[model samples]
Target: MSQPQGFDQRDDQSDRALRPKRLADFTGQVPVTRNLSLAIQAARQRKEQLDHVLLSGPPGLGKTTLAHIMAAEMGAEIRETAGPLIEKPGDLAGILSSLKQGAVLFIDEIHSLKRVVEEYLYSAMEDFRITIQLGEGATTQALTLTLPPFTLVGATTREGQLSAPFRSRFGIRERLDLYSPDELGRILARSATLLGVAADAPGLATIARRSRGTARYANNHLRRIRDLAQVSYGNRIDVAVANEGLAMLGVDAAGLTELDRRILGCLATHRRAVGLKTVAVTVGEDEATIEDIYEPFLIQSGYLVKTPTGRLLTVKAYQHLGLTPPEADENQQRLF
Candidate 1:
């Protein structure tokens, strides 16, 4: 059977096992975890539902994991849904009305919610109530339903897409940042223990350095490398084994993937600032994926820069690709 457009069977199965069940077990995003711990403690003390939370960051940086953690920490049952799935006000109402008291309603990609559906959420989030129309035209009647005092945990990769009015509804908002290699290494070490894989520090460090500063990427890379180690390396991973696995997966020492290089190559070909649409078309990726997934690491790694006009490759990118930067870019590089 074919999966849905954005669903990944591998993630569906593996993520649950690898995910940190409690906030205390989570590895990265220190600031976010810290704030959430305090909030959870306060809410528990008050014997009230936790405040609605908004978590925004690049995909695979553990927004979904954190949502589940929040639910676990609060000892609340969680109901999960995505923004695109709730297409209408009725759909939102149905999900909202079903929640038990002190439950957590996790909505992934919350910024993709429709304008009308988002508005319908205002009262539900604020007052734990919703008003719905019972009929059409002259027969229409407004019925307000009281919902359980559940905490709404919304996650988004693009927070700017949400309207100011919608954004303001959340009582708590936290933006997760990319993980440092050390943080990712710590996460990978824990994962190795859980997976029962024998891995050395250098081997895990090698994988962590190339994990694109995301714990999800680090864990995924560890799993793939573990397969290689099991079959070819006596169920043990060393630095050489990790390097071989990453090379087999087409990830470079710098952690850039084939698609990452293609995006860089596209920018290199243009030799000037290029618009996102042009890069997306050339790289065979959607604009959002490039912007949200690929571009962040590129910018963070000093391989690319975004100006008001467009994106421009840096001298580091040209060197990585074994190409020469234009003279103007060469002079600009000297300035830095």
Candidate 2:
């Protein structure tokens, strides 16, 4: 799909579904968007290239899309790769040496790079030069290759895992938060029109509320609902069709999936705040997976809350599950 300014070719259909062409098309992330705009404008006014950028966020939140936008804004060619794909330092060296002036090297999942490979990147990012060893002999000499000025756009889901040296190299650091329900609803409505799917406002609202503030999830649900409408009713998606499709997919009114229900069940039945580790153990999932994949949505929907002590169920959580609040817990009662 054609991206706005700074993106490369996308492989996933969902990426194309909500990919914003320019800064204006990208929804939500008001502060980050504003900051990026200023940075781009300042760079253009100086007639210099933009600095290297690092985007940290959960998956499916438009890191890749924004990278493409940055490239477009600069009118530069983008070369895409992942950190894990660069097995040796030479792999990254070759790609870096090939970059043209003002090119963008977009590296996804950048926290997974090996220490040696990461060391090589430090010099490349700072001075745009790669040192090569000629031979292991008495006459061995070091050859330094100076590269054209380029930008590195790195995306990572786990910012904490990146070493301070690597993180500090990025001139611009932006964090992406989950979108609001209203923002997601607009995204769904826009996508529906673009994809030629006929959906009413109510239908789009239903998809957005249940999307857990994720544009990718909203688009995915809309596609499923459209399929249901075509097969069960006609090829039109309205409120009734959206509700039926969501019900069949086992998504609750608040957009909690089966895993979310399981987490809430454990918290409510225990009648105490539970640690994330214990909750992950009980659910048979890793702590990182739970935090990165499931907890954001549950927390946003008011189905879960992280206290100083541990994870607690909110009043809305009990009501959604059709359960009475425990009488003895003062905090739970007060929350209601």
Candidate 3:
């Protein structure tokens, strides 16, 4: 995992406490909320289980929160697990067979599931049953298990890694996008109220703009700032305190963390399109972390661009890094 912006135990607890339990309470991802609301309403009216759902997005975009919200809206008990945890077909069979009628089975990082386990899930998702082979010898017998009518809510940061067959099994699919500053500001305001911290509009806005367009980061920053305010500012947050707290955390004005700048600085040094492997090695992070966590915000904020050849830093990236942009070469000028 990427070091900067990664959550810890306390942040996880805070996230759970601050997550909105109902669709109406959700702050951003308007289109996704609307689609889920319609599906939930229809499901409730028909007195049938909600269809399997696939929620895809970068981390901290509220995919897991939405899965919980969906279960809440459907009045279904939800069993949570990660894709890697269910290592064997028997493990999956046990969980599937144990769900109550109309429950929601939420799997985080669903794209990482082993292929055999994923194939084992196909039957349960389609027919509410799974076939398991008992005994691994000539005496083995096929045992088909009937499962309860439950919704499989899968959350994935790398949705493309999932097989086409697995992706198709989810009838209601939604992709969450990064939040706008205004939406993040609203979310922070609510979080402030919940956390019992007195915060000014400017303070919240400052934190929001520095949140990398993710609610989790906004709330995480709020909690940390709240700590600073409690000790030094009489439990009050203003722009100065917000900026001070964020700076202490190594978050710059553009919401770029130390790792983010390091990645950009690497690209700036190259002054050309650098492949993912090179960027990963130069930044001392794995390729997946750079691609999934850091690259999304950089690309979305117009700081970086992915080319057929490799990843290139844009003029905005150079400006953010306090460096001059280099003139493009003949073959690469078109990229600029």
Candidate 4:
């Protein structure tokens, strides 16, 4: 399914096991998890349907996992789909009508829905019904199908793209924040245990720091490192084993990937803040991807900064690249 740039793609039967099973098992977003738990309890006590939920955040922060957790916590069934898959009004209507009472209809990348389809969603969420017009000309008739009271759980990386009416229809909204390195280490440890891989704390911490504040990245690195350890060193992963394996993949000490290096190298050529388009042209990636996938981490890590004029490579970025930074203009010296 089409999603916002960089949404998690490894979601299958095998990969789904990597996700935390319940709200308690979820490792980060403490506030969000707590609030969701209370909301679920309140709804259950009242014997009412849980409010429609909106999970908005950058990709790979476990938004989909939370959607599933919501259904599990409420003891309600969940139907998973993406915005792009529901291309027509009938598609939305069919799914809505088929849902059992209090079921969760989870739609990932809700912002990608066509404007017309999105408009169709408003009534379904608000009134638990879909009004469809059948036939054309004089034979046309308006048919309103009453659906079971169901919760709509929408996940989006681009919250701004949703129309105001569509956005307001969701009764509960929560944003998932990036995980800290410490939280990521704990998650990595859990993943290693589940995968039956022998990983030490130091090794996990090393990978966590380089995980770009993402659990998916950390898990991928852990599997790769574990494979390397098994083949070359008897499956025991320590600090040395993790470092040596990751270094071979061009993941530097700061966890910057090859593309990150390329971006810094391209930006360094200008020696000044440069527009995103110029960076994309030089880096050979589209502007949308750079904005959605790359820039967030770069800015969060203090390796890059965005300003009104453009993006500037920070001193830390140059230092990580092992290059001397050029003299900065007095106006651009301070970090934003």
> What TM-score does prediction 1 earn?
0.95
Q: What C-alpha root-mean-square deviation, in Å, does candidate 1 show against the real structure? A: 2.6
Q: Could you give candidate 1's per-residue lDDT for residues 35-99 as a string of tens digits? A: 99999999999999999999999887899998998988899999999999999999998888889
Off by over 4 Å in 1: 1-8, 329-336
Query: Scored by CA lDDT, what does every candidate get?
Result: 0.88, 0.83, 0.91, 0.85
List the lowest-lDDT window of 10 residues for candidate 4: 1-10
The RMSD of every model to the true structure, in order and in angstroms, is 2.6, 4.7, 1.3, 2.3
Give per-residue CA lDDT, model 4, range 186-218, as digits (tens): 999998898888889999999999888877778
Candidate 4: RMSD over Cα atoms? 2.3
Candidate with best lDDT = 3
Cα lDDT of model 1 overall? 0.88
Top-scoring candidate (TM-score): 3
User: Any residue pairs clashing in model 3, and if so which?
Assistant: none
List, residue by residue over 1-336, the lDDT tens digit for candidate 2: 112111123326655755887888888899988998998889878877789999998767889899999888888889999989999998998899899998999999899999999999999999989997778889888999999989999999899999999999999999999998899988888888876778899888888888777777777778778889888787788889999988877788878777778888888887768899999889777788778777877887677888887988877888888898666455553453
Q: Is candidate 2 or candidate 4 better by lDDT?
A: 4
